[model samples]
Target: MKIAIIGAGNMGGSIARGLAKGSLIDDSDIIVSNPSAGKLEKLKKEFPGISVTNNNAEAATGADIVILAVKPWFIEPVMRELKLKSKQILISVAAGISFEELAHYVVAPEMAMFRLIPNTAISELESMTLVAARNTNDEQDKFILRLFSEMGTVMLIPEDKIAAATALASCGIAYVLKYVQA
Candidate 1:
């Protein structure tokens, strides 16, 4: 499946890099885009098989799965440019954006949107990633779970628990760092 990562920062880039390195997806099948030319350029050099771009819409154009990896504050702006096809699954690692709210922009009746909470430990392949499905079928849900499984163990949780999961895994990454610093 063709995959697009909309934000090629620490988390997104790390996921792409890990996927390619692990042979979970062919580097040629993966696409990455970021606002920063420097990061995109770096990504190009780091993963030569993946196409890196600055256009969010272009990055997501033909993607079967699009990862909305932008920061929480930037989700609205980024989501504006992304047009998720009905077959496309929009997975956001962004904290706090719920599935119901995310479906507002989804034009596809079969649009499969999800919220995930993955800790920084994913870089080390040790993350308790929380996943939630919205308007997704069993087949699609299993497919998504399989994809995330490449990064680490995945758990399908209730939509209500996504927030705490986000707090514990997403924002909590920084919180844990603070303790390490202390």
Candidate 2:
């Protein structure tokens, strides 16, 4: 399946790398986009097989899965700019962004959507991630679960619990690190 990651920052880059390393999908099947040409160049250098572009829409177009790895504040704008088909699954890694918000921005309340919270450990292929889906089928959910399994352990949770899960896993990683450092 084709996968497009709309941000090429730390999290987005890591997800692409982990997915490539795990062989979940061909590197060529993955497309990464960022506003920074330097970042796109860096990703291309690191994963020559993958496609890199500065055009978000180009990256997302025709992709089976579009992973929004942008900041929480950027999510809405990115969603608005992205022209995606309803059949494509939308997965957002923006913490604190709700499924309702995503649906509202995409203007497709019936669109299959997933909210994911993954820590930096995803870069090392060991992140504890939380996933919540709306209007998604069993096959789509399983496919997502399996694809993310390569990055780390994944749990399917309810939308209402995503915030708590994010606090415990996403932000909690920093708290754990502080203790480790201490």
Candidate 3:
């Protein structure tokens, strides 16, 4: 299955590496795109097997899975330009964006959405990632959960509680790190 990542920054880079190097996905099956060519080049140097693009729609085209790895403010316009197939599953990692809102923005309402909140520990493969299915079927939800499971443990939660879960799971990581530093 092909996977496309919309941004290749720190978090996006980590997730791409985890999928390719962690044996969850093959290099040939992964594609990434970013508005910043520098970041795309950086990822290319590290993982030469995958493809990179400046066009978000081109990167996402025909992929079985698409990751919305860009910043929150850029999501709507970017997704508007991209066309998602009915079979395509979107995994949104944008902070402060809710699933219902995301569903309204995508080209395909029938396109499945999975909400995930993963902490920084994912870089070390020690993350507690929360997964929530949004107006999706069992097959699509499982498909989304399976992808995040590659980076860390999965906790299924309701979409309404995902923002709260993000606070506890995402922000809480920094607090834990502060405790460690003390």
Candidate 4:
């Protein structure tokens, strides 16, 4: 399956690298897009098989899954610009954007969408990734769970509990780090 990552920043770059190291999908099937060329160039150097682009729309065009790894503030604008198809799966890694807000941003509010909260440990392929789905079937849910499970432990949770899960799995990692340092 073709996967498009919009934003070659830390999270996006890390996900690309992790996927490249995994067996779920081929590196050649992954496409990463970012406005700045430097990060894209760095990712290309690290994973030559993966494709890179400066155009978000181009990256997302034929992709089966589109991951939004941009900052929370950019989510709305980026979603607007992509004009994603209802058939494509949307996964947002940006924190603080709820399903309700995301629904307003997309062309099809009932499209299969997911909110993923992965901690910094995803860089090492050992994150606690919280996933919440909307308008998705069992098969789609299982596919996403298995896809992300390659990078880390995955928990399928209710949309209402996303904030709490985010705090425990995402912010809690920092707390653990501080305790370890102490």
Candidate 5:
């Protein structure tokens, strides 16, 4: 399966690197797109098998899964540009964006969508990733769970609980670290 990541920032880059180390998807099947070439170049150097492009649509085209890792402010514009198909699974790692907001941004509201809240620890392959699904079935859920499980522990939560889950798993990591230092 081809996975395209739109954003080469911390979360996106870490996910790409983590997936490259996993056995589920091959490095060659991963495509990363970013407006800036610097991060893309860095990722290409680290994982030569992966494809890097400046065009978001180019990376997303023909991809089975499109991960929107850009800043929340960019989500609407990016989604508008991609015009993602219903067959593609949309996973957004941006915090604070709900399923309703995401559905509004996309052309196809009925498409499978998920919100993933992964802590900063994802860079170390030890993130507590919280997942909230919409319009997805058992098979898709299992696939997503397995795919993310390769990076770290994954929990499937209800959309209503995403905020609470994010606080406990995502932001909680930083709080724990601060306490440790203190």
Candidate 6:
């Protein structure tokens, strides 16, 4: 399956690295994009087989799945710029963005949109990623969970509890790290 990662930042980069290292996805099947060439260049150098580009549209085009790992502030703009396809599944890793908000941005009411909140542990393929969606079918849900399972444990939760889950699973990791450092 072709996967496009928009935003080669921490979360996006980690996901790409984990997917590549796990061999769950071939490097050639992944495309990573960022606004600047610096980050994309770094990823290309590190994961030579994965395609890297500065054009978000280019990265997202015709991919089976498109992951939005950009900062929260940039999500809307990126969505507006992306030429999203009906068959493509959209997953957002941005914190605080709701499924409804994402749906509005995509402008495809029937589009399957998922909210995935994974902690820094994703870099090590041990993240507690929370997945939530409103209208996704069982098969689609399973597919997403399987895709994320490559990185770490995945839990399907109610959309209403996404914030709490984010706090417990995402922020909770930082808290543990701080305690360990202390």
**Worst lDDT window (10 residues) for model 3?**
118-127
lDDT of 5 by residue, 1-182 (tens): 99999999999998888888888999999999999999999999988999999999999999999999999899989999999999999999988998899998787999999999886566567878889999999999999999889889999999899888878886776799899999
lDDT of each: 0.81, 0.88, 0.81, 0.91, 0.92, 0.87
Q: In candidate 5, what residue range of length 10 has the lowest lDDT sum?
A: 118-127
lDDT of 3 by residue, 32-142 (tens): 988879987887898899899989989889998898887899889988888787688888889878877787787678677887777656656767888877668887777
- As a whole number from 0 to 100, the lDDT of residue 116 in candidate 3 is 70
Clashing pairs in 2: none
User: Which should have the higher lDDT, number 3 or number 6?
Assistant: 6
C-alpha TM-score for every candidate: 0.90, 0.95, 0.91, 0.95, 0.95, 0.94
Tens-digit per-residue lDDT, 1-104, candidate 1: 89999888888887777667655679999999998899888878977998988898998999988998888888877887686788788899887777766776
- Local error of candidate 1 at residue 117 (angstroms): 1.0
lDDT of 4 at 145: 95
**lDDT of model number 3:** 0.81
Score candidate 2 by TM-score against the native.
Answer: 0.95
List, residue by residue over 17-121, the lDDT tens digit for candidate 2.
888777679999999999989888887898899999888999999899999999999987898899678889999988888887788877567889998888767
The lDDT leader among the candidates is: 5
List the candidate 3 regions with Cα displacement exceeding 4 Å.
179-182
Lowest summed lDDT window (length 10), candidate 2: 100-109
How high is the lDDT of residue 126 in model 1? 63
Better by lDDT, candidate 6 or 1: 6
lDDT-wise, the better of 3 and 5 is: 5
